[model samples]
Target: MAQWYQTWNKPLKNILWWLVIIGMVVSLPLAYTRHQTETSANQVEFVFDYRDLLDISDIQTNPRTFVAEQLKNMKAAGISSMAVYESTLAELKESRRIEVYNSRDAAALTQTLGDPNENFTYVLFADSATQQKLEPLIQKTFADLKVGTKPWSFKNRNGLIIQMSMDDASIKGMDPDPMTLQMLKDQGFQIVVRLSNRRPFVTNEMDRLLKQLHDIGVKRIIVDGNEVPGYTEENTEINLNKMADLLNKNGIGLAAIELLKEPQKGFSTLSKQTNYNVVRLHSFTEKDGEKLTEPLKKSELQDRIQGVADRLVLAVKDRNIRMVFLNARPVKSLDKGKLVDPLAAYYESLQGKDGAIPRIQEVGFKLGPAEPFDVKTTGWQKIARIFILLGGVSLIVLMVSFFVPEATLLLFVLGILGLAALHTLSANLYAQGLALSTAISAPSIAIMLAIRSVRSGAAAKWKSGLAYALWTLIKTSAISLIGVVYEVALLNHVTYLLVLQQFRGVGVLHLLPIAIAGVYLLFFSENNTYRDKIANIRSILSSFISVLWIVVAGVALAAVYYYLSRTGNEGQASTLEKLFRSFLENTLGVRPRTKEFLFAHPLFLLGAYLSVRYRHAVYLIFIGVIGQLSIVDTFAHLHTPLHISLIRISYGLVFGALIGLVLIAAWEIIIRSWKRWVPQLSK
Candidate 1:
């Protein structure tokens, strides 16, 4: 049976290669559908946090004048929307809508001794307009909380006396200030309401709030605190479904903030209930604003602002972010002996020459209210994905055949069975598993083929060797892109695009292909027969350990650790590297990845050229794995647009090849000079 299975391995592998090709052809249209979905929403919204503006304005000598000036500045800077948070007593005080005092303070103002037992909160309206607009809202909010309120007057200014302590009264949640919303609307600015789950969930109250917001043309709501609005009531009669229904009925969508410490509680459920009507938002936090304005010299400040602009542009153009939320805080400038804000810098970054607005508009986006992606799936997608699934499985089996040629058919059977079981358990797990497997397999196979070509023979001349190296690089990249196609096709869902779901096994995708290539190089590169390869591996395993070997192993391990550490978004970059990266972004609208263009591709190119002549240079094929894997890994970033990823990888290949040619020329000169001047030393 074993001999028969071994005999069929060659034919089975040949058949699997065809399956991979067919799968790639079938997946192309699926990729096109994803491209269409990505391009469906092209409007971006710039939203300023109104609460942060109010807080910053509080530090100014003329708070109202400062706010009015900033509002005009914001409009000039292309900010079209304001994010309004749910009101609290503290916020109302900041806005100067009302003043609150404890029982003792009220007694002092009245010039009468206070009763020792009375601990009521006193509210005095800023003006008649404030009194008329806020009195009902304050009364309703306290009524819902089962707290009593009575009318009062201080010097002819009507106010409310709440039968609760100042501390307790200040924390209660109220509706967003109607006056502020109406004012923002009248100013031609869109409204984005931020809701928190701190208040007791009341169906009628939420419905009324949503309806009022809808009347003002409010399109989206962002959840505040740690939970979405109705999360606390999920287990009760009022659940996320009901909340989602209210939002849907009121035509209000949700804004999914990117990179929160954790996703808002009940957000996923609410989003689903609302038919995935969600736009991705990227927030420039108050801390980030302060850092940008931190007492830097003129040049450094310009660089920091430019860096911020670059990030915002990328967030919109590449990462599917349609909402850019800007926050500002007053920074104490000891040098200037006053509080300064980054508002000016922020405005300039948006509307100045070479700013984010032009760049964003250059990339086919307009400043407007952001809309969610119109995700639609066709019936044909299901049918095409079947072929993609088959192709992915066959590719994995073909990779296994490289090491266990005799078990190719058995592995295919097992892969099919295992995938079926995985699909039964969870379709998402199946897709991610197949995606990761094919991601590693494609690059490993591509590098192995390059190594095989190297083992065959060296080119007779430098020119021919350089041509062969370039061809090999192109071929390897093309092969690696098979995995890219597989990944894009399998994970083509709005959830992945929104980052609600992620492509798992990224660390393995970055590390495993290189390890597999390294293994093939150690035991199988020179051996033509499986038995010989097994013998070579067993001999190495049984060999005595050496101190130098251990040292080399330790160094290799450390290099690998550092390499893996730099694989994800959380990876740290040095200041010089950040400057270099910014330079690349400024120069090339899309920055090619550093590892590919600088380290992986160039070395792979040089290695390919040199391996033609020198046997030891074959070891560079291990380095070649990095470029191939990176090409595939680039697509694994599901949020980035397909066109952007394609352009980035294309640039990586072009630039990497050019650098590799220079290295090849330099190597030739050194070799020739050594032979001419010092033949004995060269030998």
Candidate 2:
């Protein structure tokens, strides 16, 4: 049975390779379709927070005039939209649309003492238009909560008295201020409604509100709280589907905020229900705004502005963001003895030669209403994905077979069974698992193949070795990109593109390939037999510990810990590193990753060259694995456009090769110097 299994294993492995190649060929069209989808949305919107602007205006002596002037400034500064939130009494007061008073203040205005027994909330409109626009909305809002209201007069301005404490009445939620929306529209700026789930989900009321917004030319909305509009935890009837239906009826899509602490509840379901009419938005927080406008030197302020512009440009050009939300606050500048706002700096960042607007336009996006990607599916996509799955599983089995050759047939069978079980559990989990498996396997196999080729040939002279090393680098990167194609094919859904779903197992992708390559180098390289490698491993395992080994182990552990720390988005970079990144972004429209271009790719190229002659230099293949894995990892960021990742990888390879050539020349010089001088010194 054992001999028969061995006889079949070799042929089975060959079949697996064929299946992987066929899968890749089948996956190419799917990847191209995804590329088409990514290019569908080309317009970007810049929206300023209306509430933040209102807060800034409150500190001015002429608040109303200040707001009007700033709105004009905002429009001139390329801010095309204003994000208006649901109204509260406090917000209305801040906007100068109305005034709120408790019983005591109302009595004082009338020159009478407070009526303690009849404590009530009072509101006075700024004008007849305000009164006409807001009175019924306020009345209906409070009446729904069973709060009583009656007509009141204060110095001939029409007002209402509510039978509730001032504190209780102030917190009631109402529809977004109609006056603000109309004002924004009249100013030639689009309106982006901000919705919240603070009120009860009433279908009739929501329908009316959406109709009103549609009339005002509102194109999209963003949820302001932890849940999407109409989501209710305790009410099964009030769900995202109902909200999606209303949005669809009104022709308003959703704006999904980027990098929230926790994803908005029911957002994913709502996105799907709306047929993925969702655009990604990146927000400049009030805190970030304050930091940008801090008292700093002219050069420092310029650097900060450039950094912000680069970030915004990348967000739109590379990460599929269609909306940029800017927030602002008044900063207390003790040096100037006044409160300062970031409006001027914000404007500068958006409207100059080096501003975000020009930078964005240079990259093929126009300043207009942000729109969702036009994602379409073809009938052949599902069939192509099946081949991709087959290829991914075969590649994984082949990687395992390297260590367990006799069990190649069994591994392939088990891979099929495991894929079925995983798919039964969750289709998403199955796809992510296979993607991660193929990602690891492709790089490991590529590096091992290079190793085998190196071992099969005699060492070459430096002149020919240079060309050989470059060829090896190209070949290895091509193999790794096959995994990238499979991954993109497997996860070619709008959810992944929108980041509603993420590729899992990033840390494993970063770590496992290097580890597998290291193990292969130690046990299988140089045509070593399995018995010889097993004995070598046992001898090392049984040997007594040495202090040098312990020290080396400690250093390796620390190195690994640091490497893992830098693997994810949460890694902290130093100030100098940030400056360098900014410089790179300015010089190169799309910055290749630092590790790939500067560290991994360069070292990998050098390793490929050195491994030709020095037996000990084979260890560099472990480092080379990093470049291979990184190539595939770049595509794992599904939010990044396929073309952008390709450009970045291409830049990494070119730059890495150039730097590798320099290293090769420097090493050659050092070696010749040593050969010429060391012998004379010994004599």
Candidate 3:
């Protein structure tokens, strides 16, 4: 009976094992194909809406025509910097700067002759904020100019090449009264007081400005939006209501509230009591000014504009408002001679549908197509995948269960030891699973060889050979199980979060299941009793120490990476440190406030202590998992919302109770099985 069993079991088991091996080989390529198919890109379509077009007739008129013409010549010359001399003929003869233009002739003849000097600056007839937005662009374009100072900062656009300022002679209405001049100055009109007309509460200068604005092609504007600079009558309720109704009646589309700067003074009756929904306006300043004539330059602008456009379009699509106002530096000529179609231009800039700008534009706008929605893996698909992977692993395990069961037990233990070691070395739990798989494959073959050796009586130490083979299997299983547990818990949390938050980090937890399966193998190695294995605690300690050394090596490597990144390496040391710090802070709830020294922190000591202590490993694992699981509250670069110490205490208590319950249940099962078997054996 023994002979027949041995002879048939050996060949039959080998054949069954080969079938499982074939299945695994088939799975790899198929799995790769499935993964690729799932992640492949495909075309999708969606509608998009663009923002309102700019109104620029004021910059295109007679005196202002020179500003537009100079800008046009500058664009044509590709020389943004220019110098304006007193005489046009003198400037044209010896000067290379863009020739100055007189206030009238429709052509407003300004032509660039040659290269302008680095210090050459443009004359802007606009306010300080409008001038501020030109520095970055000017500096980059005429890079040699080092035109880094904003227009508003300098006494004049250093050379007054292309000027944008109100014509000085246009200020005519003055009663010549000291009190009135003082009152205008006190009312905050050093440059020009654009006031409300025919109103009991305010002056009439704004009505005159609006008339001038209309003459210069400003068909629609809201004078009420312009906040009077120095009108600090404590109760502005009546003023705001009258202003709002006046604006609504006048059909003004834009308003500029000036110097109501204190946002936290709390909403006054102007905002609270009125129906005029004030959309906060933001626009380009001298500090933010950069041209976008190039393709990539425009792409950047498109992205930013489209992002805000998409948000607002979605938000305000149902409203009757046809145009929204933004403060922007005036645009005269977009490209040398090409006229940008205002209606078509704004629509194309929306970055929607076929009109979307190409991805290469380099502009401030940071817009792009919305990311593809990720489909949640259904339960059946997940179950199928999990079963297939586990089945392949279990087949190998089953083979070990047949012969040299004790060796299988040892291998399982060793595999777990290797897994924990690998995890410490590489924070990835899935890498530990792969390492366990590779480590166990060799042991499986070795056990088979050892069994053959014992069967043929080539070596007399059959019991010892069986013990070694079983030991190998047990170590492998332990590693596999530990890895599995790590994987399951992590993946469960991660997948749940992905479902909840729809973030990419959700897939990060998927690695945990692989680690758990690897760990499970460690716990259930074939035919080895816990009593027999407990005697090898010294060996377990040695393995633990060995893994600890590898962890130390990893720490040394991380330290070296940190040091080189900071000191001499031409790399982003600060960025790398921030990334590492972010990961650690999330995992340990031990965020170092400053980026001064990461490796030398007390947390490193804690990690070292946990590495050396087995009990601490359990605590660190739970703390690490929960710490990673906790929501991060980030304000700028600061991350909050994790309390590592609390997490450790809570997880330790909960997991300890769980482990105790499992042990008790396991003990009870063992006793029941023993009672049933022992009585039968005695009978």
Question: How well does candidate 1 score on lDDT at residue 369?
Answer: 94
Better of 1 and 3 by lDDT: 1
Higher-ranked by lDDT: 1 or 2: 1
Candidate 1 wrong stretches, greater than 4 Å: 1-7, 233-238, 456-463, 528-531, 680-683
Q: What C-alpha lDDT does candidate 2 achieve relative to the native structure?
A: 0.87
Which tens-of-lDDT digit does each residue in 1-683 have in candidate 2? 88887788779988998999999999888888899999999999999999999999999999999999999998998999999999998899999988999998899888988867988999999999899999998999899999899999878899999999888888888999988888889889999999998898888888999999999999999999998877776664456678788999999999999999899988988888899999999999999888776789989988778777878898898889999999999989987688998898888888855899998998888999998999867788878767877889899888887677777889888888889888889999998888889989999989888776766664344457777789889988998988898888888898999999988887799989888888877777656687899998999899999999999999999988887777778877889988887787778887888888888877877877887787466566568788889899999999999999998999999998898888888999999999999999999
Task: Give me the displacement of residue 282 in model 1, in angstroms.
Answer: 0.6
- TM of each candidate vs. truth: 0.97, 0.97, 0.24
**Roughly what TM-score does model 3 have, to 2 decimal places?**
0.24
lDDT, candidate 2, at 163: 92
lDDT of each: 0.89, 0.87, 0.32
lDDT of 3 by residue, 1-683 (tens): 66665565445445545544444443444333322322321211121110011123223435334434433432232221111111211211121222222233212223334333222323332344323432232333233222232322233433233221113211212211122223223422221112322223442433443344333322223232234321245645555555444443443322222223333221233333333232222222222222322233656756544544433332122111122222223444545454322322233433444222222122111222112212223344434333334434444455455434434434444544654465568544543344234233323333233223323333343344324323432332233233222222223221111121112222223233223322323333223566655555446567755687999879967954653454311436455554564454434434432221221112212222222222232222222221121111010001101122224323433333344334435655897999999999998
Q: What are the per-model numbers of colliding residue pairs?
A: 0, 0, 101
* Pairs in clash, predicted candidate 1: none
- Give the per-residue Cα lDDT of candidate 1 at 331: 83
Total clashing pairs in model 3? 101
Q: lDDT winner among the candidates?
A: 1
